[model samples]
Target: VGRIKTAPACSHVPELPEVETCRRALAPRLAGRTLTDAVTPWPRAAATPLVVTGRCIVRLDRRGKFLLLRLDRGWLVIHLRMTGRLVVVRELPPRTTAAFQLDGDEWFCLVDVRKFGRAWQVARASEVVGHLGPEPLSRHFTAARFSAMLAPRRARLKPLLLNQRFLAGLGNIYVDESLHAARIHPLRTANTLSTGEVRRLHRYIRTILRAAITEGGTTIQNFAGPDGKPGRFRSRLQVFRRSGEACGGCGTIIERSVVAQRGTHFCPHCQRL
Candidate 1:
C-alpha cells in the first residue's frame, strides 16, 4: 500500500484537512513576522529544528499540502498524514493530542492519517533528496520524471499519486480529481502512458493540485482549516464521495470503488481506461 510506517496505524495520507489545518495554523505568526526556531515536541514526526527564527518570513506556501516553512537555513517541510494538523493555540490545546511545537507561539499537531506519513526534518531549502519524488510544479519534476516514476512501477496510479516519495503533497482528493480531469483510468498500470498523455497528465496533476490548494482542499470529516473552519471544496467535487450522483460534465452517474487500496470515485463514461 506504499506505507512508510510513521507512528499510528491509520490508512490515509495527506488528505485535504491536514493541509488546510497547516495553512490556518501559521497564517497569523508566519504571515508578516519571522520564525526564529523550529521545535519538535515529537521528535519522530515534526519538521527540522529552528533555523531562521527571528528573520522575516519570506512566505508560507504549500507544496502539495505539505507546509513549506521557508526559513533562512532551510525549509521546514511538514507532511501531515491522516491526522496531521498545525494548530496555533495560545498555549497548548489542553488536550492529550497536543503533539509538538513549531515556532515559539505556534504549536503543531500531527493528527495522523493513519499516522503513516512522516515529517521530513530537512536542513536544506528547496533541495529535497532521497526517496522524495518531484514537486508537481517544479522544473525538475518534468514530464520525464513523471513518466519515469510510472515507467517502472506496476502499482495503481491512485496509490502512486498518494506516494509522496514519488510526488509530494498530493493526496486522495487531488488524485481522484486529476484522474477524472485527465480522463485517464485510475487503475491503469504505470507503463501505459504515451508521450501526449504524459504531458496532459502532468498538466492536469499540477492544475488540479494548484486548484485544490486555492480552494483549501476538501473537507469530509473532522478536518477544519488552521483557523478551525470547514472547507468548501467538497461541495464542488466532481467524483470524490458522490457515488450514484450524476457526473458534473457528462451527467453519467459517478461510480465508486477501491483503487490503490483507497476509496476512489470516477465516471465510467467521462473517464475510460
Candidate 2:
C-alpha cells in the first residue's frame, strides 16, 4: 500500500467502513460496561440521552453508518454524520458534542466539529435504520438479488448506490471507487446495465468495502480510527479524487463531473459512459 501524510478534502460523510472501524474499537471496551451518565454539551447531540444512563451495554453493533449500542433495556443509536468522531479517551477531547461516562475510567465521546452527529435511545434499532436496504457485504445480498433490484430503478447508478434505502453502507467515496473498478459509468441509468455488468458491480462493491474496512476506511477529510489513525485505504484509492491524474489502467487522464450533486471521478477510457 502507498503512504500519504494526509487525505484530501474531497470525501464526504463516514460510510460503512468508517463506522465499522469505530464499532470494532468500541465493542471491546464497552460491551459489558454500564452507562454511568450521559452528557451532551450540544443539546441536539442526542435525543433522550439520559434514558440510557445506568443501563448496561449489551454490545456495539452497526447498521449502515449508524452505531447501535445495544443496551439491556433499549438501543442507543448514533449516526456520525458528516463530521462525527467516536473516541474513547481519559480526558474529553476538544469539540466533544456528547460524552458518555463509561466504566473502567474511560469516556466514550462524540467529538464532532460540524455537530451533525446524532444519538437516540429507542426500543428497536429499526426505528432509525429499519428503512435501509440490504447490506452490500451481507451474504443475502447476492448478485441475482442485486440485479433484480436494479431492474426496476430508473435512477443513475451513482445516486442509486448512494441511496441507503436501496443499498446500505455506501457513500460518495466507496460508490465512486466501486463504480470505477467495475468499469461502470456513474451517469449510466440503473436499468441499462447487463447481467455481467451487474455481477461485476456487485462484486466490486463488496470487495472494495471489505478492503476499506480492513484499512480502517478512507480518510478523505476528518475521519480517523478510535486509535487516532487516519485511514490507510486512502493510499489504495483508484479514482475517487485523482482527477487530472493518469488513469492506472489506460494511462488516460481521469476526469470529474457532477453526478447526483456530488463530485465524481473516473477514467473516461476505463468507464466510458
Candidate 3:
C-alpha cells in the first residue's frame, strides 16, 4: 500500500479555519457519494460508530473544529484534535485510524499519528458538537453581543478564548494574532476590557479568522487541506511562534510565556498587562 503523506509531529491543533478548509475541499468531492464500507484500525477513534454503509453524503459542514458529514440518514462528525489529518485518496495510507470507502473508488481516510482524532456517527450533529459556542464568523456574533458576552467573565483572556464553550473555532494561533492586533494582554481579565477594547478585540477576532480562512489556515505542524496542501497563512503570522522576531507594529522584540497552560506569544511593549 502507498503510504499516506504525513507532516512531522507537532503540537499545532487544527482550529476553525483549518477545519473549514477541509470542509470546503471535501464538500464537492464527497457530495452525493455513497459510503461503500467502513474500516477502523483504531476502533476507539469512532466514538459512536454505527453502520455507515450505503449512507449517501449529502453535504459537508463544520462547527468550530469539527467537520460534519451530512449523510442521508445520520451525521458523520470528525474532530482532528492534534496531528490528525483527513485525506481522500485512491490508495490507503499508513497510520489510518478510520477510513470510509467511497463508491467512486476513493477512500476517505483519517490519518492520525497521536490517535487523538475522533469520529462520531449520530442521528443529529448536536450529539457531538452541541456544546460548542457560536461560530466567530457567523453574522450572529456582533460586536455588541461579544461585549455582552465578555462583561461577566472573570477568566483570563487566553484561557477564556481557548474554551470551546465561550467562543468556537479559535486556537492558539488566531487567539495570539487577534490579541496582538487588539493590543490586549493574554493574561488580562476578560471583564476588565473597556467598551472600545471589546469592540477592537471582537473586530480583530473576526478579521483574523476570515483572513486565515482565505489563506487556507495556518499550518504550524500537520494542518493541511484534503488536497494535501499546507496552509499559507503561516507566513502571515505576526507573533505566533515568532518569539524573538521584531513586532510589526513596534520594533520591540516579541516574547513568549505560558498562559492558560499553552504557549502564549505577544509583544511586551505593545500589550501591557
Candidate 4:
C-alpha cells in the first residue's frame, strides 16, 4: 500500500464558509450518484449506516458547519468537528474514519486524525439539523433582523457570535475579523450596542462571510475543498492570527486575548469597548 497521507493539526474549527465550500465541491461530483456501500471503521463515526447504503445522493447542502447529503431515502449530515475532512480521491488517504463507495469506482473518504467528525442519516433533515440559526448569507438575514436578534441577548459579543444558535456559521477567524472591521470590542455586551453599531456589525458579518466564500474560505489548518485543494482566504485576512503585527486600518499593534474561551485578535486602537 502507498504511504497514507494525513491532514495537519487544525487551529480552527470548520465554520460556515469552509462547510459551504465543501458542499459546493462535492455536490457536482456526488449528486445523482448512488452509494454502493458505506463503511465506517470507527462505528461511532457514522450512524444509521443502513439508511445510507444504496441511496442515491440527490443533492448536497450546508447549514452552519454541517454538510447535508440529500439522498433518495434520507439525508446524511456530516459535521467536521475540528479536524475532519471529506475528500474524493482515487485512493484513500490515511486516518480514514469512514468511506462511501459510488457505483463508478469513485470513493468519498472521511479522514479525521482527531476522530472528532460525525455523520448521521435521518429521514427528515430537520430532525438532525433543524435547530441551527438563520444562514448569515441568506436574504432573510437583514441588518434589522440581526439587530433585533441582538436586542434581547445579554451575552458578550465574541461569545454571542460564536453561538451557532445566535448567528450560525461564524467561527473564531471570521468572528475576530468581523469584530475588528466593525470596530467593536469582543467583550462588548450584545444588548448594549447602539443601533448604528449593530448595523455596522451586521453589514461586516455578511461582507466578510461573502468575501471568504469567494476566496474558498480560510484554511488555518487541515481544511481543504472536497477536491483536496487548500483554501486561499487566509491570504486576505486582516486581523485574525495577526497579533503584534501592524493593524491594517490604524497601524496599531494587533493584540490577542482570550474571549469566549477562544484566542481573540483585534487592533487595540481600532476596536474599542
Per-residue lDDT over 1-273 for candidate 1, one digit per residue giving the tens place of the 0 to 100 score: 232121111113445334644465455555655544444444555343334446555566666556665655456566555565555443443221324433545544445434443555456645544455666767787887788778888887888878877787677777888888888778877688777777888988877666655666566775433335555566777888888999888999999998756889999998787
Candidate 3: tens digits of C-alpha lDDT, residues 129-230 = 999998999999999999889999999999999999999999999999999999999999999999999999999999999999899888887543333677
186 Cα displacement, candidate 1 (Å):
1.2
The top-ranked prediction according to lDDT is 3
Per-model TM-score on C-alpha atoms: 0.71, 0.93, 0.94, 0.92
Give RMSD to native, each candidate.
Answer: 7.5, 5.0, 2.8, 3.0
TM-score of 4: 0.92
Model 2 Cα lDDT, one tens digit per residue, 151-188? 99999999999999999999989999999999999999
> What is the lDDT of every predicted structure here?
0.62, 0.85, 0.87, 0.83
List the candidate 1 regions with Cα displacement exceeding 4 Å.
Answer: 1-28, 31-65, 68-77, 96-129, 224-227
Ranking, lDDT, top scorer first: 3, 2, 4, 1
Where does model 3 exceed 4 Å of error?
A: 1-12, 222-227
Which residue pairs collide in model 4, if any? none
RMSD (Cα, Å) of candidate 2?
A: 5.0
What local lDDT does model 1 show for residue 72?
A: 52
